[model samples]
Target: MVGKFTVVDGHVHTFASEEVSGKILTSFNKLYNIEFANPGTGTITDVLQNMDSVGIDFTIMANFAPAKIIHKNNSWSIEVGKKYEKLVPLVSFHPDMEEPMDILMEEYMRNGAKGIKFHPMAQGFDPDDNRLESVYKMSAEAAFPIVFHCGRVSNARLNNYADIDMIVPVIKKYPNIPFVLTHMADGNIGDVFKLADMFENVYFDTSIVITGYPPLLKVNEPSWPDNEVVEYVISKVGADRVIFGSDYPWGSPGHDLNRFMEMRIEDRQKSMILGENAIKIFKIKSSI
Candidate 1:
């Protein structure tokens, strides 16, 4: 209803169990208490309906389920992919686990995970720390890209968390691996712009920035509006270096998909932000 082009929401999470109550609040203070024992809200049907209603053609859905939690829920993400052709699964792994890298590759990835996710803030690790090198190496070897959580930690204190500096070295060392920085690095726009200029394998997702972050960070700013941040990053990294992200369910409580589409951008640029750019970089098929 908003635009003719097919859209790709690069980020969304599914809860594992519907029985145990876990509260997740957006930066805006909107809270969603998830029951781990029950069925997930972002089921295959729910994803299809939401995408169809929003005019989105495809989505890269991600999830994190610890062993203590309903670890089996992680499989549901792959299930969503099976149930809906448009859904692509991004799998998660726990860092504290030993050689978890091998497990991810042998099990989740071989099964059909399109990408991997790293929650430095929530997952409790620094993206740049040497400890994650194994994880990065595995992802690189698999030729799959990784999405990282970047920005201020509202949920937890991650040692050396939320900075491109921590992860930049890894990106530099493993030039072949693709790193996707989510939340625009959580206001690390300048560093992100630099990385786009520096590495061909690095990418940034534009999600929830317009609302989750303060006005100063908006890419569509009037003078050098927040959109300038978007334009600058695009200029430095090239349009392909940037991908569209909603930070959905969390960022969605305040920002709507239509407003995200309506931002100040040229038609072609909008097309890239919506879905085209991601298709090229991730090698994902476009519904268009």
Candidate 2:
């Protein structure tokens, strides 16, 4: 724990192998025209080591891959969570996959999946697609929390797939399922506030937006929220609805944690954002 706080990283990505991690990083470099720092290859071992370095007690594995390989990636994520006590796995699913939703959910739940991770932009599906109604219905019945990559990626070919509007319907329909929108819904902070005001089950994870993108030298201008902006957001939404996430590999856990700890907020709010809120929202049972 980080001095009286359990410090759970609400969002992180893990890869099956170092090669895949390297490739993903390379793609990001090409897209952003900047070299990312050595964030330890995005492997399970790398993630655990980073967590230990930063005093993060738990990390939710928010891994996602192309639809063709999603099942395999999710299976690996589940196995990793099963083997590591501190790693909480949130598997990904696409409605276009050949496997039926019921069968896939059964397999994922039977194998110890903690929740679901959806990246409509990465997986190339619309969040409000009619095809996903079954997925949402089943998730509601099972009460699975879904962590969404709810903002646009830098230099992405398309951005509408995960837009706030695209996700609003599902969030409204599945009130039983906790929906954690990552990156403070990135470019949609206004809508994010509206959603937080409207739905008690909606949550916002402070990932890249809270600390800005990593390796400060690469950024042309300060694109993230300032201390005042962040404080205002927390105050408006209430500390209970904000979660701490490092967006590991793309962002540093150590740097992000230190920055957050230094924010001009009360110890009570810091404690909530750092870990307490995530634990309650994700339904984590580990003793903090």
Candidate 3:
């Protein structure tokens, strides 16, 4: 895999149908005024083919949906994981969902769910809400990693929901559970370092921040980090705590992996960020 290195995309979004995937892309395009990259239509078939193209041995499914349909979305994710060994599913949770957190956790964990994904902005819940205490407790007890869509989202109005300060309490309360702040905390480099320094269990995922969506290159907005910035983050956070993620359907796995592989970091560091750290953090049984 990738010439002596096992590669795992630690963060990816998948949809059960292309219609849903297209709607998501459309929404993002409208919100950001940019045509986000669509590497594989967010379907399992497309994701598998994209992974094969880049030698991505495994990918953590970090799909999230509206509260009304979260159960169905997560159920699809779990079933997909069972059917496809290479796809590891992380179920989603929203405090507003009718089903209690305990019931959802029991069902999801029993059905082979690897972890949890929380998009506070998309799910419309504050990360530090009192309602999420049980979620944190269960995750800590089970040592299940929780991936958060940290930093700004396309809708600036909802950015406050995922602010780094909002999740600090939960991170402090559950020191044992792994908390992966995706998008390199959305390029909040100082805050990223502060969290990494303070909490040993806190990790970062390099998704859109490592290599910006290709389509956005012509846009005036700041997108991804330069090579120097990427290397600086790796040095500051250590490769052991940074994981590779394509943010597929929005960012291409092939392009992101190529950009990542070209970084000046050492081979061991690359190996760790590309796959080893993911296996250790997610408890993925590597077939590579």
What are the models' TM-scores?
Answer: 0.78, 0.93, 0.95
The models' CA-based lDDT, in order, is 0.61, 0.81, 0.84
Off by over 4 Å in 3: 154-157, 217-222
For model 2, residues 1-288, the per-residue Cα lDDT tens digits are: 898888999889888788989998888667655545655677888998888888999999998877788888888898888899799988888878777777888888778887889989878898877876777888898888898887666434465888787888889988999899988877456877899989999988887777744564255232354778788888999999989997787777788788877789999999999999888877788765
Residue 220 alpha-carbon offset, candidate 1, angstroms: 15
Please report how far candidate 1 places residue 128 from its true position, in Å.
Answer: 4.5
Judge candidate 2 at residue 96 and give its lDDT. Answer: 82
Best by lDDT: 3
* lDDT, residue 33, candidate 1: 27
lDDT rank, highest first? Answer: 3, 2, 1
Q: Per-residue lDDT for 1-288 in model 1, tens only?
A: 246665777877654332222343322233212211211245455556667766777778766655344235557777767777687888776656543566656677666678777776566665666655666787777667888876653332346655666767777787777788876666555676676778888777876553433332333221123555555556666666667776544444124455555566667776777787666655676546
Clash pairs, candidate 2, are none
Which prediction has more favorable TM-score, 1 or 3?
Answer: 3
lDDT (Cα) of model 2: 0.81
Clashing pairs in 3: none
